[model samples]
Target: MKIVKAQDFDLRREVEYGSPEQNEAVRKIVADIKKEGDAALLRYTEKFDGMKLEAASLRVTQEELHAAYEQVEPSFVEAISAAADNIRAFHMKQKRNSWMDLQPDGSLLGQVIRPLHRVGVYVPGGKAAYPSSVLMNVIPAQVAGVPEIVMVTPPATGGKAGIDPYILVAAAEAGVNEIYRVGGAQAIAALAYGTESIAPVDKICGPGNIYVALAKREVFGAVDIDSIAGPSEIAVLADDSADPVYVAADLLSQAEHDEMASAILVTPSEQFAKACQAEVQRQLAELPRRDIAGASIEQYGAVILVGTIEEGIEVINRLAPEHFELIVDNPMGYLASIRNAGAIFLGPYSSEPVGDYFAGPNHIIPTNGTARFSSPVEVDDFIKKSSLIYYSKEALLSNGDTIMELARREGLEGHARAIEVRLLKEGKAGANDDNK
Candidate 1:
């Protein structure tokens, strides 16, 4: 890793919008699925995933789900179950109930919160198959009371015609019985538009390759999507008090995820920056995925030198990293200064992987500077909110004239008349009731 002055380093990275050829290919795939439904889904699955399947074999059977348990160790099951409990407990606090506020004028105004009917979670197959992702995506929807949680993955794992057993076990543990063997853009289309075998979902969540990301973008308005996620990122803001080994390790955790992933360190001390830079190179050589992590660190990683800790924070806000670590003498002292991180780890012990797996926060965080405007996946992603309005006769009559005046000012006579007609009829009824 090269150490550079913070002001001299360019923070901008070109966003991946997919090549024109890839975009055109995804458009064709999505259009085919929308038009032909199940046939297109099957054809694309066979063409891309190399699995020829009838509609009957699309859904994973309950027996298969149970058999997945035998394949995985009891230790894995116990760990996942404990993590599930922590996830459920943490998200339950975010759950909200429908509420109505009654006014003195006998009017009601509030919000009605309801869970989505169905949701689709895409778990990538092969090397990207992560059981932790299944728990992260499904558990939140479950906590939000989503009734039908559907999962889809590639049919082949390691060139075989079957899903990963670990993925199956995780889905079963998360209470998702509806699992499908499909992947790539075709799977995203199937989830959004629905085929003969799989019902359409109200929302889609999870991470995937470029094709899957493009498919989600294409079908966004047709169904809700979590986000078109970018590669992982981690930025550590530390001083001389921090451990170079710990900081270097945390940065590599994200760098290993993808060659495009970024890992950087912003520090006030030049000596500390040099230490971390040397430590990272030493650790990178020993990493199992050194090729991937080494590529990321070589291309996107940096050790930025700042004049002060406050200056370091300003640099962090500009980058808006997906994961941030504050490892200083007083991490909490600078807590309020951080405004753009997707997830913040305050101390040396609160490693990023802790939150990624067992800490109960969703690991599906925004990346590529998206943390400036977005957030990690949470319970709110699976629920929709509708405003509630119940106006009594008195309440409507009291505000009717004002409402009509505003509506007519906008040249909406129909909207003005909607209030005018109600006011006129209610006025007459009130007069008659008073006379009686």
Candidate 2:
């Protein structure tokens, strides 16, 4: 990691997000799936993942789900259950109810909240196991009363023909009834447009690699997506009272995610900056994913020196990191100063992994500075709201002219005419000359 002055660094330096070729490839994949359906799904599975399958065999069977339990230890089942309980409890607090208000003029105004009928959740598989994500994606939808949650993962793992048992176990524990053995851009397309075996979904959630991200962007209108997520990131705000070891460990946690992942430390003390740079080097030597983390640190990681803690916060807000840690003298006092982070961790004990695995908060967060506008996945992502309105005769008689007047100001004759027709039917208001 390089050390630099805050004024000398550009916080929004462009990282390796994706390429045009990848976007074109994803577009073609989505088009093929939309047109060819199951046939295209099978072809892409064999081409990208080397997994051959029949149309009937795409969905995981009850036997497979049961055997997934046997493959894992009893302790894993207990842990998943506990994590699921925590996640469920946290999201239950975000649940909403459909409500209607009775007006004085006998009008009914309301917002009807209904959980989506079916949703598709993408979990990255094919030699990667992140069962925690399964819980994060499904729990909020379940709390919002969604009836069906379909999960998709890569068909093969380490040259084998099955997903990781832990992923299957997590899904089963989370009450996911439907599971499909497809992945990548093809899987996203299949979910959006629906293959013969898989039905179409209202939305897609969870995270994936570059190809999956591009595919979601391509299919956004066809099917709603959680968010177009980018690489994981962390920005830690520290002072002279901060611990260098803890700061370095937290930074490496995100750096190991990808070469494009950014890990930054903003501090007021130059001594702490140098100490953290050296600590990151010492810790990187022992990490299993050292090569990837080293590349990330060399390319994107930095220790920036600011004049004061307030200046450090300004730098942090400009970057708008996916994760922010305030390892300062009084962490809670600085909480309100943070304006643009996907998640906030205060003090030394609240490590990034606590939110990633347990602690009841959804780990799926906005990346690539999108936290400035977007938010983490919650019950709202799995549901839709329909605004309800009922206009009484008395209400229309009192308000029709004002509505027509506003519509005529916007030059929307058709809108004004519709209101005029209603007013005429109710014998409330006069007709406009254009309509006559």
Candidate 3:
């Protein structure tokens, strides 16, 4: 990790995320899946995941889901149930109802809110498994009233044949019935385009590696995808009043996620910056995942020194990090001025992992400076909105001439004529087919 002044840093030019090979590979996989369906998907699974499968065997059996519960401890089951309750309680607050407004003209105008018919959640497998991700992804969709929620995880973890038991149990507990033994870009393709076994979903949500991110970008129009999240990154905004040990531990929390993950600290106190730098090095030695965390810290970690907490806020907004922690004298006082963070944790106790696991907020957040324009995945992501406009004879007669004028001004004579038809029928316009 390096300690540097903010004036010397250019965060935007530091890194280039996805590679051409990754994009090309994903493109080829998505194309093959679209063309060959089950056959292409099966081939990819065998080639990439080392799992040979048939169309009939792709979907996880109910027996597997039930048996998964037995493999895990009772305490684990209790924990998952509690997490689900918290997640459901939080997202249920975001649920919306279809609403209409009646006009004085006896016309109706409203917005119709409806959940997606089906949704797909992709859970990463292999070296790391996040059953927490399964809960975060499915709970919001379930809250939004999505009837069909399907989950796709890789075929194996720790070189075993079946998906991780924890992930399976989490899915079963979260009310996800349809589970598929597939992953990576092929899993994304199967979700976007239906196969013989797994049906297409209206939207896909969850985080993955670069290949999965690129696949989501490619299949965007075929099915709605949550934002393309990059490597997990965290920016801690602290002042002299902050704890250096607490700051260092929270920074490494995101760093341990991936070698590409970034952990940075922004503080106005020079003493605090040096203290955190030393604390980070000391703590890095004790981590079991020291290699991964150290690599991430070496590659992407930094302590940025600024003149004041106000300047630190400017730097935070510029970075627009996925997760932000404010450890200052009064965290809430700075909230109005702080703009660009996927999730803001106030005070030292509001550590990043708290939000990652037990906290109800979605851990699947916008990453790599995308928080400037994007948002965390929520219940709204699982639903679609339709505008409703019902015009009555009285309403049309009152506003037809103005509507016709605007349409004709845009040279859309057909649009004007459509409005003129009703006006003419009601004796509100001159006898002419043209809107003029």
Instruction: Give the per-residue lDDT of model 3 (tens digit) for 330-405.
Output: 8999999989999999998999999998879988998878898998899999999999999888888888888888
All candidates: TM-score = 0.96, 0.96, 0.97
Candidates in order: C-alpha RMSD to true structure: 3.2, 1.8, 1.6
Question: Which residue pairs collide in model 2, if any?
Answer: none
Residues 29-110, model 1: lDDT tens digits: 9999999999999999989887789999999999999998988899999999999998889988889899999999999999
Compared with the true structure, what per-residue lDDT tens digits does model 2 show for residues 130-218?
99999999999999999989999998742384888899999999999799999999999999989898999989998898899889988
Best by TM-score: 3
Q: Which parts of model 2 are misplaced by more than 4 Å?
A: 15-17, 158-161, 429-436
Candidate 3 regions exceeding 4 Å error are 13-17, 431-435
- Model 1 global lDDT (CA atoms, 0 to 1): 0.91
What TM-score does prediction 3 earn? Answer: 0.97
Candidate 2 accuracy as lDDT: 0.90
- Top lDDT: which candidate number? 1
